[model samples]
Structure formats: structure tokens, C-alpha cells
Target: MRPSIKILEEDMKEKVVLEAMEILEEIGFFVENTEAVEILRNAGINVDSETQRALIPADLVKKSLKTAPQSISLYNRDGDFVTVLGGDNICFDPGSAALNVLDQETNEIRTAVTKDFVDFTKVVDQLEHIQAQSTAITCSDVPEKISDRYRLLIALIFSKKPIVTGTFVKESFEVMKDMLVAVRGSEEELRRKPLAIFDACPSPPLKWSDLTCQSIIDCAKYGIPSEFVSMPMTGATAPVTILGSIVQHAAETLAGLVITQIVSPGAPVIWGGSPAAFDMRKGTMYLASVDTILMDLGYVEIGKYLNLPTHAYLGMSDAKILDTQAGFETGMGSLLAGIKGVNMISGAGMMNFESTQSIQKVVIDNEIAGMTYKFVKGITQRDEPIAKNLLKEFDKKTHLLSHDHTMKWFREELYLPSTVVDRSTNEEWITKGRKSIGERANETVTKLLSKYPGVSLDNDIIEDLTRIMKYENVDFKTKLDL
Candidate 1:
């Protein structure tokens, strides 16, 4: 049997879904976009224009769910099938839209600039364990209006991997689509093999903003995959209990689903979220709290029960720096999510409760993901009687090292650590100057950036992108010499 983890029982999952439907029917969310409200109204749902509240019937929610695909496939820039986004297929990417990065030179958090996006994308593109690239860090140096599309443009230039990105405002969504079209050379080709998936979030406490609503409509119209990231801080923006927060998340996500499916019947949508608990004493949010992990696992079970692709904000640390605390939280959360078969887990490079991104953290998390992937492979039964062959080998050699069985099994059974994880003798460590994981990570970052292997875009396509950038008057200061 394949490795897996289950938190909610069958009946328990049903209860959560029923409660979510009830919440939708009674405490429906307010629709910020007039078009979205009209869509729901046309679908036989009740909409009160005065309150901006659209009461979604349980049947409508069920119908919308029926239209959502259970799986999605993402393609790379070369038009090659890369990763599937559903079932037990787990994928990991760096965090999205962080304001700052942990500088390797100063060892301090600083506002991330345009070069930071280029450098970060270069590092992520090289990490084997990181399945997709995200807008890892926002470019503070770029114009505020173009920052979202600028980050996507830079990621496309520097990485061949499929991307996970988002735009906060509505107008920029079109600009981002234009950029993708410019790179792909046509709108139909861009839709056929979309290189990026956009994250559309819902304001908590049963609310939807105009910008996010419009983004959902636009993404669906263009056939782009949309990930519904519903963030509910328990005890603050949502119910204090974990289960309560989950129910609210379900309702919020279904509300977005209704809007998307109504706009475009067969557009792709992911059952995704990033729910957390509010730390009352610290007056802060904890995405790495133990409760948060449980919430992620629980909600993933709900998504599986509903037969939808899953995504979660996991493997993140509340701690400001990489330390023992960061290690334990990230390792446990990542391991659980992997075993639970989350389709895509974001927040690999995040720190300080999603406020910062670190390339070193990305490196360390890559190793963590490697270990988790190994564990989720589980053990195999190569032979009918497992101990019989071992007994025969022991009788002959007193050790299995020289046996054919050992040679065949050892390679697949063990997970060797990368250079970032030191498993050396004390003397060897001293010989190598006893560098810490962080120091070793810095070395890895330098080596990867030095030999960054970005895909070669056609000169005409590059010129088209440049023309778009120049026409928009956006600055392009990213260093791509490597």
C-alpha cells in the first residue's frame, strides 16, 4: 500500500461539508462585483443588491462542484507535460508575494528588489525538489502598478517550471494575461499550455472583494487555472475552533467556485486554502502552529472527499530565522502534508508567518521535501518471504553488504542527504571548516546562480516581451548574465 495519512473519518468529513453548505445557504457571502452577483442571480440564486449578499442554495453549490475537474495538468514553457495537480500527486513551490528576503550578505531582512526575484527564481528553478516556481518575492523597486506582472515576466524569463502566482488588482490581471500571451506568441496556445496558475483569495468572514471577484471571472474566461486561497485566522477573522474555521473555508471556496463555473462552465479550479490560528497572547497569526497543521490535514481530507484537487500553505515557519524551531515546524508540517497527499504545498521559502522569503530557507526546505518524498514512497516487499533471503545471506557472509539483495535494495531504501545536510565525521567536518547548513546553503545558492540554466526563448518572443515592458514603461534591471 502507498503511504498516506488520514485525519477525518468518513462521517466527520460529511459533517463538515453539510455545515459548510448550511453556512452558504444561510450566511451567504457578499458579492463585491456586480457581474458576479448577476451571474449568481441568473443561476437561480437569490441576490439582494441592497446588501450585496448573494444567498447560494445548496443545490447550486452542488451543481458547481459537479462541473469542477478532479485533476489538472500543468505544462512547462517547452509545451511539455510536467506535473499533474490532483490526486495523491504532491508538488512543492516557494512562497508567494513576500515583502522581504533574508539577505545572504547582510544576514538581515531587506525589502526585496527586482534582482531578488530573478535570483530567487534562478535558485528555485535549479532545486530538483521544488516542483514549481512562485512569485517568491515582490519587487519593491518596480512601479507598484506593474509589480505583479513584472514578477511573472521575470519568472517566465528565468525558469522553465510551471508557476504559482497572483495579482491583487483586476486591471493587472489582464496585463499578466497579455504578458503570458506575448511569451507564448498567441492566446490559444497560452490557454492550451498555461505556464502559470493564479491564486484568487477570498476575504474571510464570508466576504469577497471586487478585485478578487473580477480576477476569478477573468481567469475562468481565459481558461487559466485558479487556486482558491481562503485565509481565515481562527479567533479573529473566523471562528475560534479549528473545525469552525474549516467549515467557513469550505463555504468561501465554494462561493468562488460558483462564480468561476458560472463564468466559464469547465474552467479549472483548485480546492485550496491557507487557514491559521490567531495567537491572542502575541496578537499574531501562526501558520506553523500545530493546530494549523491539523487544520491543513483536515481540510485536505475534505477536498479529497469532494473529489477536487487540493493545495495548502504549509512547510512555513513563524520564526524569523532558520533555527531549531524553523526546522521542527517545517519538517513536521511538510511531512504530514506529503503523507496526506496534498496536491501542491506552498510556503517552502517563507519565514516570520509569511512575511519574508529566504533563498537559504528554500535550499533547506528542498532537502526537507526530498526526505518527505522518500518517506512517502513507503517500504516495498520485494520478495514473498522477506526474512528468508536475509537469513540465507547472514548464514553465508555474516553481513548483507556483499549480497546481491543488498546491492539491489540499498539504493532504493535509503535517502542520502545532500551537501546541505551534513552527515560527516568530526574530523571531516573540521577539514571542511565546519560550515553550518545556512553557510552551506549560501554556497549552494552561489553555485546554482552561477550556472543558472534558463530556457532559451526565441529572439522574436523576447523582443515582443521587451516591447510590452517598454510600452508599459516598466523598469527591467534583473541580471541574467548567467
Candidate 2:
């Protein structure tokens, strides 16, 4: 049996869902998009145009819960399976919209730029453990209005992996859709093989921003998958109790589901979030805190109860760098989320409270992801009663290396990590340079980049994407010419 972890019992999960439904009916939520409010009004929902308060009824929530697809498929640009999101399917990707990167050359945090996004995508493409890629960092070099779209463009041009991206600016939404079409050939084909999933977040305290609301409706209309990111800060924007936080998360995501399904029935969406507890002592939100992991697992359990695909922010560090603190936090968060079977666990390369990205840290986390996945896979009984025969034939002079059984099962039974992790004796360490994990990871990154061709697109698609970038007045060639 595969190793797994869960905290909420079935009856407890039902209670959480009931509480969420009650919150949606009694308290309601704010809908900032005027069109969204009108859609709800047309659906017989009680709406106050002045306050934007949409009191979604229990029937509407239940209908949405029924209509939303239970599973979502994300394909790479080449139209291949990156992951099927639902049930026990688990996948990992780096986080999005980080502003800084830990510069390997200088060993200092620097503002991330377009090149940083490109290089990050290259690393993600090479990591077998990372199933999908996100617009890992926003390039400060690009125009603020087009940064989100620019990241998507870079992802398409550099990596063939499925992408997790979003648009913060409303006007750029159509442009982003057009950019996707440029890579995907046409609108219908793009929808049929959606190479990316957009993340639409709802504001805390029961509010959905106009952009995010429109994103939900647009993604539904376009037939692209969307993830509802309901970020609730406990003891600040939400209730302090963990159960209360999950209830709030459920309510918020349910509101999104209602909006999305209302726009287009049976639209695909994932139950996703990046919530955390507010630490009064530090005067900050502990997104990578251990408590946050519990909260994420609880929300995922609720999603599974509804038979929906789930996602969460895990495998990140609240620590400033790739030190001991980063190691333990990332290891624990990744292992727990993987074993819990979160469909799409984000925040792999994240550091310093998820504000920065690092190539070295990503390399390290890639190894962590491999080990966690191995642990989740558990041990399989490849053969029965074979150990008795092997033991009977074994002697003090015999070696397992000489046996055929050892060679056949060793590769499958063990997780042989790459050079990113060190497993050497003191003498072996001295023979080498006694390099740190960071140093070894840096060397690996260098080797990977050296082998990467830097660009992976047909001439026609490249020209079209560049034309779109130029239309936005973005200097795409300047950064990608390498």
C-alpha cells in the first residue's frame, strides 16, 4: 500500500462542508466584478449592486459543486500529459511571481529579470521530479503592465512543460489569450490542449476582486482550467482556529466555483490556495509554518470530500536562505504534502517566506521531491518468499553484488539521487573539494545550463510570439538572444 497521511475524519469533513455552506448562505461574499454580479442576478441570486454583496444561496453552491469537473488535465506545449489533477494524483511545480532571485555569482539577492525567468524555466525543464512549470518570477526589466504576459511568453518559448500562470492586469487578459494562441496555433486548439492553468485568487474576508472574478468567467468561457486560490490569514483576515480557517477557505473557493460554473457549466477548475496563519510574535504571516501545512491538508481533505481536484502551497521555506532552516522546512512541507497526495503542490524553489527564487535551492528541492515521491510510492512486493532462498544461499564469502536479484531490484527499490546530495566519507570528502550542497547544486546548474540550447520553438511560432511581444513594446529579443 502507498504511504499516505490525513487528519480529518469523514464526519469531521462533512461538518466543515456544512459550516462552509452555512457561511455562504448566511454571511455571503462580495463580488467586485459588475458583470459577475449581473450574472448572479440573472441566476436569481440576491445581489446588492452598491455594496457588491452577492448572497449566493445553498442551491447555487450545490449546483456548482455538482457541475464542476472532478478531474483536470494539464498538457505540455507538445500536447502531452504533464499531470492529471484529481484523486491521489500528486505533482510539483515552482511558485509564481517572486520578485527576487539569489544570484549564484554574487551570492546576494537581486531583482529578478527576464533572463532570470528564462534560466529558471530551463532548470525546471531538466528536473524530472518537477512535473510542471510556473511563471516562477516576475521580470522587473519588463513593463509593469505586461510582466505577467511576458512571463507566459518566456515559459512558452523556453520550456515545453505545462505552465501555472496568471494575469494580474485586466487589460492584458486578451493579450495573454492571444499569446497562448500564437504558440498553440488557434483558439479552439489552445482550449482543447490547454498548455497552462491560470491561478485566480479571491481576496480574504469574503471578497472576490474584479480581475480574479473575470478570470474565473473568462477561463470558463474559454474552456481552460483555473485554480481558485483562496488565501486566508488566520487571526487576521480569518478566524484563528484551524477549523475556522478551513471553513473560510472552503467558502471562498465555493464562491469561485459558483461563478465559474455559472459562466459555463462543467468548466474545469481545481480547489487551490496559499493560506497561512498570522504570527502575532513576528507580525507576519507564516505561510511556510508547520501549522500552514495542516491547514492546507485540511482544505485538501474538504476538496476530496466534494470529489474535486485539489492543490496547495507547500515545499517552501520561511527562512531567508538555503540553510538548515530552509532544509528542514522544505523537507517536512514537501514530504507531508506529497504523502497527503495534493494534486499540484507549488512553492518548490521558494525561499525567504516565498519572496525569492534560487537555482541552487530548486536543485536541492528537486532531490527532496524525488525522495518524497519515492516515500509516497512506498515499497512494493516485487517477489514473494525470495528473501528465504537468497538467505539460504548466502554465506560470509558471498556478496549480494554478485547475485542477479540484487541487480534486478536495487534500482527500483532504492532512490538513487544525483550529485546534489552528498553521501561520501570524510576521506572522500577531503579528496573532492569538501563542497557544500549549495556549491554542488551550483555546479549542477552550470552543467544543465551549458547543455540547454536556451530556446525551444519553431521558427514560425517564434516569429509570431516575438511580433506579439513587440506589439506590447517588450524587448523580448534583448533578453532571449543568448
TM-score versus the correct structure, for each prediction: 0.96, 0.98
For model 2 the TM-score comes to 0.98
lDDT string for model 1 (296-396, tens) is 88888998999999999987898787788888999998999999999999989899889899999999999999998899888888887977857865655
Q: Give me the displacement of residue 40 in model 2, in angstroms.
A: 0.8
Window of ten residues with lowest summed lDDT in model 1: 473-482
Q: Candidate 1 has what TM-score?
A: 0.96
**lDDT of every predicted structure (CA atoms):** 0.86, 0.88
Each prediction's RMSD to truth:
1.7, 1.3
Best by TM-score: 2
Off by over 4 Å in 1: 475-482
